[model samples]
Target: MRLYSEQRFGLVRACVARDGQPLLYAEGYALDPSLTLWGTRSVARLSAKSGRIGFLKLADGQEAMTDLSDPDAINEGAALEIEIAAEARADKLPRARLIGMADGPLRRLSGPLPLIERLKSQARRLIDPQAVFEAAEDPDALDIAEAQAIHPSFDLPGGGYLSIEPTRALIACDIDMGGAGEGMIHTPRQAAKRLNEVAVAEVARRVRLSNLAGLVVVDLIGNKHNGEKLTGLVRDAFLAESPAIACGPITRFGILEFSRPWGARPHGEDTPLKAARRLLWRAVAEARSDAGGRLKLRAPGPVADLVRQCLKDSLDPLTPRLSVETASVTEVVPVR
Candidate 1:
């Protein structure tokens, strides 16, 4: 989340250690006026080889390299340490004094130390609020355009519309026993148990697909039955979805809160199927309007090819004025 400068571009860098070694580094860039920032586009460029130091070009074309070979060159190697003389002036660039040598090979020349210092000095000013806002808003248009294609007027069970919000905390689901029946033979307790079981399964699936994490609250249908039965059902459901997720005991109000560890946060809200359909439709429309009026799409490989074949088989019979094309976006992976 911190921002720094790198050359003329703004750089956001974070220090990370791997295998007890302070080697991993995260670097991001602020978008220039012409470019739009959308979602978490920050790429974590890690060193592929051990003891190897190199620079990576961020999205904004800002360069960052580690000086692992020499400690003296602050801007030349992966190491950031440097020495200064007592008489050194504040305005002038300090002379590079060799403090120590690193135990690795030097890959490339780091940027100038004065420029690096200036970037570090103006780090606060570079962290622009406007830039974050611009980036966050860029993805909405695409999501909306995609959603419209999938469901022109899709409606949720409740009156709420589909929305994407940015938050550090994970999303939780609560199911209340609405105006359902409470019978003497079946008992309200039995109904509550069934509803709780269904809610647990559905919530788990949503968490996985949405990449939700942290605390999750699930308010089940309140019943006069034993709380132990409800707690056991929730526990079993959690285990079935993911054993790693830890859950607290059911609360007196019949609320179950749990946590799911997510490797990375989601950038957008469209499901895989919905995203693919939107992209495909947009490309078709574009291709139709082009000079040649022919459409060609780059898909992920076999899947793309299959989609293209399906499109051809379905649309070829129409014999329309424009030609539609299809291809694979990527290679197929074994279904989990």
Candidate 2:
């Protein structure tokens, strides 16, 4: 496996590619990575309690939710060091597990480890993603991989396409033949089987790529009466990666269901602040590469304000050479 790091503009973006396929992508501030918060132990106060569900406030003022192993053992306002299991979502708090009570002051004891240390186990070769981005042609390899994680539709190997939509409840995958069998009306079953084969393989790769967890339902292209064959194909595809925690047979509606253990937050689920930071980084790169003495970056009003407010320090070095303005769309261009 190869890990690519693009360290620029006070941000570090990394992608892990195995066997020519990009599986995971993560980014964070230069010093502290948001990914490190998961799986790290920290001190937090039990702000509020409701039975086994407890609300925890970290020293940094962040809140998380975790089940109290012994609800009776701890009371509200007490301190406990908890291990974060997963990062937070837009509507949900981070998931944590109690690691026992703490005696010291409420603060981060250790954590936010170096990005390389956290991800080095999965990769052997360290690469530079920016090199790939600069050398690649239109639809760069890294860009295509990143787009697949965010975009809902991706084409199959030979033909057809699959739409993978992840909702709060489960991930739903829909497959379409889409002219894969245009002139083969005589062999509909044979054509459908081939399409389904391609769809299942792509579906499995996407599940790993997007870090999708929980229940996943796939609606295959053709409706045949072979449940075992469909599930077996999925199982074989996921055998290399972590096999599903549980795999269910295909349903009558041509749907297959399976569940995988939660790993990290799904890609493209960034908060507004994180998105703004990324945009600012892109703008900075544009300015650095331009030959003009001055450059103007037009971005959404809120995004412009974010950089001007919270990220002013990041731009101080390039002031006079770069300026930001509010526009409906975000882009950077050299000043005349």
Candidate 3:
């Protein structure tokens, strides 16, 4: 797999690709050596306990949870060492595992590892993003624009499309044959089976790409029998992408159910911090190109405050020209 990292919108964006196709994308503040949940060792105080689960609060006030072997072994407010296993995704809290009791001072052993280092561990070849962008017919614009897409659809290789609906409870996937079966000279049943197979493979890729977890229901374009026969294919397809998946048999209603583990943050979650970063990134780019006196970032109150708080960390030689102003909408423009 090839990996590329570039600074955009005040954050380091990384993309993992295989055979010239993007597999995964991630973004973060690379220079900040402060507290972060992903890939860090820190000390936390046990805030609460319930059976085998122990809730903890780090020195930076980030909440995490770990499995305790014995409920009564450690009391609340006790200090413990932890290694963060995964980041906070969707509504789920960050996950960590106990590394034994902490020593004298309750402190963080290390901050979050750099995002580029993390990507390098998994990638086979590291190439400059500009090279990839220049060579591709349509360079991948990895940005927050995806968060604006609520109900996204992807066209399948054949004549069909897959519509994905992500709700608070679960994700719903619908397979529309469209014109995929038009030229097929097989029986209706056979044609549906063929389309289902291709659709399931694509579903597996999308699930991983979006970091979709919890319960997922896929509505295949086939009958109950066709759904049942395609169960193994579904299982294998998901297994190739995510190994720890629990797949249920095809239901009588022609639906395939399965669950995958949550890892990274959901691909398209729009938040104030992301908006703030985007505005700053644009402001910085504008300051670099245009001979402007003041680059004012106008955003919503919350986003503007976020930009002000992070202004120091993101500023480079353009520090003197940077400013933040509250506005109903978010934008970065020059001010005389």
Candidate 4:
């Protein structure tokens, strides 16, 4: 876990890579001990909507004064990590490291899961664990690191794929069963079931990784049995990650509906300009950290152009110490 410089790294994710393939990941939240539930008011002043998520306790006849300066301790994010790590480790063979984050208020992770663990309870093998605590080491990690602003599409293990979209009405995931399960099963019905099985598992994984919540509509291509099987599979899939998930019977259109808690914002709200600024800082930091290497930043056109100037204006002092480049693209990468 790490403490984020909200100004620089907007939505940071802890990514574990098995070789070059992007594996499991979790988003990072700021860990400032000084930070509190109330930003500008005391508990007594907190409105019903603005009130925090804890209870106050006192002894009989004891009257306590509201101390706006000191609020309750907050480490649930860290605690969750610790619990997840433990659960992930029961199978053994994976190692975890709290790298880059120093012992201070900036630490963001808390958990027992090590460097690697089985991707899930049903996976046959454990993954080689490695977290992106600092900066992304490759283009894939950088690209898939954060999901809030990421494209909704995700590739499955076989040939099928998913396109996730957060629509105004609900979160929609359309599964296009490609050749992935074609040759694996002989009959069309069998192939549909095969793809349905694979799609359900992957959809569950994607939902958790992307932290996509609320009314979710999944469109799968298959028959009634295939849809029914998929509905059960999805329920079982989210049983651990989100037990509160409510899945119902599939419709004639092969749509499965379910809802999960909107625990937190999947991605922090960062304007493109802010993202551009952070990219510039990343480039400079990378360059400085590496005395002679050049760090190239690939981002959308507007962001690249904006950061190019940021490098020109604010980063002048570090010019001699750093070598950086920014390339423009059509899509924006939240962070690298």
> Which segments of model 4 are wrong by more than 4 Å?
1-13, 16-143, 147-149, 181-186, 226-228, 241-243, 268-278, 281-336
Query: What digit string (tens of lDDT, one per residue) describes model 2 on residues 1-336?
Result: 555665544556666666677765566656663422667678888999888999998877788888987888888989898888767764878888788888777777666766555555323212222322311122254565666666646877777889998888988899999888888899988888888877877787787667677788888876774678777877776664443357888877888888876656677585555566667666666766774568777778777776565446564556557677888987777788
What is the per-residue lDDT of model 1 for residues 113-182, given as tens digits with 9 covering 90 to 100?
Answer: 3322322322222222222211122233333432332232222232212222224454546565554333
lDDT for position 131 in model 3 = 29
Candidate 3 off by > 4 Å: 8-10, 32-36, 120-152, 185-187, 224-243, 281-294, 314-322
Least well predicted 10-residue stretch by lDDT in candidate 1: 32-41
User: For candidate 3, lDDT tens digit of each residue in 65-123?
Assistant: 88899979899989999887666766767888788998665678975567666554323
- Ten consecutive residues with minimal summed lDDT in candidate 2? 130-139
Q: What is the TM-score of each candidate against the true structure?
A: 0.36, 0.82, 0.79, 0.50
**Residue 167 miss distance in model 3 (angstroms):** 3.0
> In candidate 1, how many Å is residue 307 off?
17
lDDT on C-alpha atoms for all candidate structures: 0.37, 0.70, 0.69, 0.46
Question: Residue-wise lDDT of candidate 4 within 117-162, one digit each (tens)?
Answer: 2122112122212323333345335445454234547676667787
- Clash count (model 4, backbone only): 17
Residue 107, model 1, lDDT: 25
lDDT assessment of candidate 4: 0.46
